[model samples]
Target: MKKKLISLILTLIQLSVDFSIVAASISLVIVIILVASTPFTGFAHELFDYHSWWSLVLQAVTASVLVFLAIIMFVGVHSLLRNINSGLYFVNQNLVAVRQILWPSLVVFVLQSLASICFRL
Candidate 1:
């Protein structure tokens, strides 16, 4: 019964991770679309109050980086969960997936810090 319970929990986690992966992929597509259409549609100006081209560029770059990181994080999490579900929890592939998730999280933290400093300046 305990093994069955653990399998059920892992299955639930896998489902949630799959949903998150889909969400992240959709976000990536949306960010790409927004970045590409900003100049033509003036959507950033209207929605974000970005007055200058530089600000728009900065926003686009930041959004793209963030979306990419989110994708990486979600994908890594999905891989890790898949490994766990497959009874390979202590394998090297799982380690690589964990590193993939960790590095992206650290990058996001650094990116946020830099953005804060840039804004203050």
Candidate 2:
């Protein structure tokens, strides 16, 4: 019984650490993208001038990825904060069910709309 309990505690600890790193990564990546957006625009334009076609392709792909990451970060952080709160008040009286319109969903929706504009260009 003692060994089992020890292993269970260890697993929970590892899970928490792993989730913390993932949360941090998401936040850090979002900040990096927002901060570096302008500089990357210059690089994108420079690549566009190269006439490779692949540059534009790569640019589109990279931008889409960053947008996706931003959305994920937003959602993940929101969920984390919710979990840190007292309980799932808005959704259910229990902890098992939760429903919230998180910002990450909004971000993804906006990004997809912008993507359509990019495709038209």
Candidate 3:
């Protein structure tokens, strides 16, 4: 029963990870489109209160970096999940995958905190 329950939980996690990957991909595309169109549309100014082209550029770069990191993190999580599902729970590859996810997540956290500070100022 415990094995079955664990399997069910892992299956649910895999599904969640798959959905997150798709969502993150879509978000990346949308960020790219919005950044590409911002100069011409002046939407960033209205929406984000961007004061200048430099601010918009900074926002665009930050957003792109964040999204890219998120994608990397998700990919790492998928890999880790794959390893777990395969019954390779304590493998080196899983450690590497965890490290991959960890670095990106930490970077994302730092970047977000910095962004919040900058915006608030």
Candidate 4:
């Protein structure tokens, strides 16, 4: 019964991970297209003044980058969880997978902090 309960919990977690992957994939694609087409979009130019445009672009780029990073992290986590569910949770590769999920957020936080300090001046 204990094993059955553990399997059930893992199964639910896997399902949640699958849904998150799909959601993250769709969001990442949409943001990528938006960032890519920024130069070509009239809304980016005609809809805002120079400073406003620059700020908007900076924010958009930051968001796009974060979303891209999140997608990578999500995929890494999905792989790690799948492996764990398959009974290989203690392997060496799991460490790499854990790093893949963590390093991007740390980098993003550092970049965001720097950007805030620069903008404050």
Judged by TM-score, which candidate is best? Answer: 3
lDDT of each: 0.84, 0.51, 0.87, 0.75
Model 4: per-residue Cα lDDT over 64-114, one tens digit each: 787778777877787787788788979987888899888987987887897
Residue ranges of candidate 2 with Cα displaced over 4 Å: 1-101
**Could you give me the TM-score of model 1 versus the true structure?**
0.88
Q: Would you estimate the TM-scores of all the predictions?
A: 0.88, 0.32, 0.89, 0.76
* Candidates arranged by lDDT, highest first: 3, 1, 4, 2
Query: Deviation in angstroms for 18 in model 3?
Result: 0.9
**Candidate 1 clashes between residue pairs 3 or more apart in a chain or in different chains:** none
Root-mean-square deviation (CA) per prediction: 1.6, 7.6, 1.5, 3.2
Range of the 10 consecutive residues with the lowest summed lDDT in candidate 1: 42-51
Against the hidden true structure, what lDDT does model 2 obtain?
Answer: 0.51
How many backbone overlaps does candidate 4 show?
A: 0
Model 3 per-residue lDDT at 89:
88
- The true-versus-predicted C-alpha distance at residue 74 of model 1, in Å, is 1.0
lDDT of 3 by residue, 6-113 (tens): 988988998898899899899889888888888888666676558678778788878988989998998899899888988998889999999999999999999999
Worst 10 contiguous positions by lDDT, candidate 4:
44-53
**Global CA lDDT of candidate 1, please?**
0.84
Instruction: Give the per-residue lDDT of model 2 (tens digit) for 1-121.
Output: 9856755665565466457656657765654554455344555555333334554554555555655555455445445444444333454432232222345455557776885576556
